[model samples]
Target: MSETHNDPLARVMRRYLRRSGIIHLPVVYSTEEPVVFTQPVSDNVLGSFCSVTGTGGLFLAARVIRDLVDPDKDGREKK
Candidate 1:
C-alpha cells in the first residue's frame, strides 16, 4: 500500500495530534484494501476488532511516546 500525506483526513489527524503535543512520533497515513474473510463471522465483531486494533493502537502508542518525552508537562501548549 502506498502512503498518503495529501489526504484531507490525514491532515486533520496530523493537526489534532500536533495540537495534543504528540510531535515526536511520525504520523503515517495509508490506505489498503480491506481484507475480508468469508467465514461464519459477524460483521459487527470483525468491525469492532479492526477498529480497536487499528485506531486504538495509534492512540495507545502516541500516549506512550508522549509520556516518555515529558511525563510532567501537560500536552496542551508547546514549550
Candidate 2:
C-alpha cells in the first residue's frame, strides 16, 4: 500500500528475505562503504582462500600459489 512497495528492487528484496527467513515485511538495508586499498597487495595474500565455515575444512588458498594442490603430483608442492 506504500509507494516503496511498488518498487521492483523492494519487491525482490522482500521476496528474498522471506524465502531466506529474514523477515515477513520490508526492512532497511544498506551497502557497505567502498574500501580504498592503502597498501599494495602481495602475491602471498592474493590467491589465498578462506573457509566459509571458519573451521574443520581444508585450506586450499595457501596451497594454490605454491602449486601444492596438484592431484597428479600426489598433492606435493611444485619446485
Candidate 3:
C-alpha cells in the first residue's frame, strides 16, 4: 500500500510517542464535526479523512501541541 493510503497521523503519533517513551497508551481524537466526502469508510478514518478533506489537520496538531505546552492557559485568552 502507498504511504498516503496508511494513517499518517497515527504513524507520526506512534513514532513521536515511542520516542517520548510512551508506549502503552493509545491516543484518540474525538471528531465531532461533520465531514463532506465520498471515500471508502476505511480510507475515511482519522487523519486520512482530514487529509482527504483538506480540513483542520494543522489546526488540530497546533491545538494538541499547544495544550501540551501550556494547557493551563486558555488559548482564547491570547487572542
On TM-score, the candidate that comes out on top is 1
Sorted on TM-score, best first, the list reads: 1, 3, 2
Candidate 1: stretches off by over 4 Å: 1-52, 74-79
Q: Lowest-lDDT window of 10 residues in candidate 2?
A: 25-34
What residue pairs are clashing in model 2?
Answer: 49-61
Clashes in predicted model 1: 0
Specify the highest-lDDT model's number: 1
lDDT of 2: 0.45
lDDT of 1 by residue, 26-61 (tens): 343445545667887765674445765688578668
User: On residues 1-79, what C-alpha lDDT tens digit does candidate 2 reach at each position?
Assistant: 1223435676676677767887433222223333456999767763323543333133444444335555354343488
lDDT-sorted candidate list, best first: 1, 3, 2
Per-residue accuracy of model 3 over 1-79 as CA lDDT, tens digit each: 1112245566677778778887554233443444566866775467455464444566557767887999786455453
Per-model TM-score, in order, reads 0.32, 0.26, 0.30
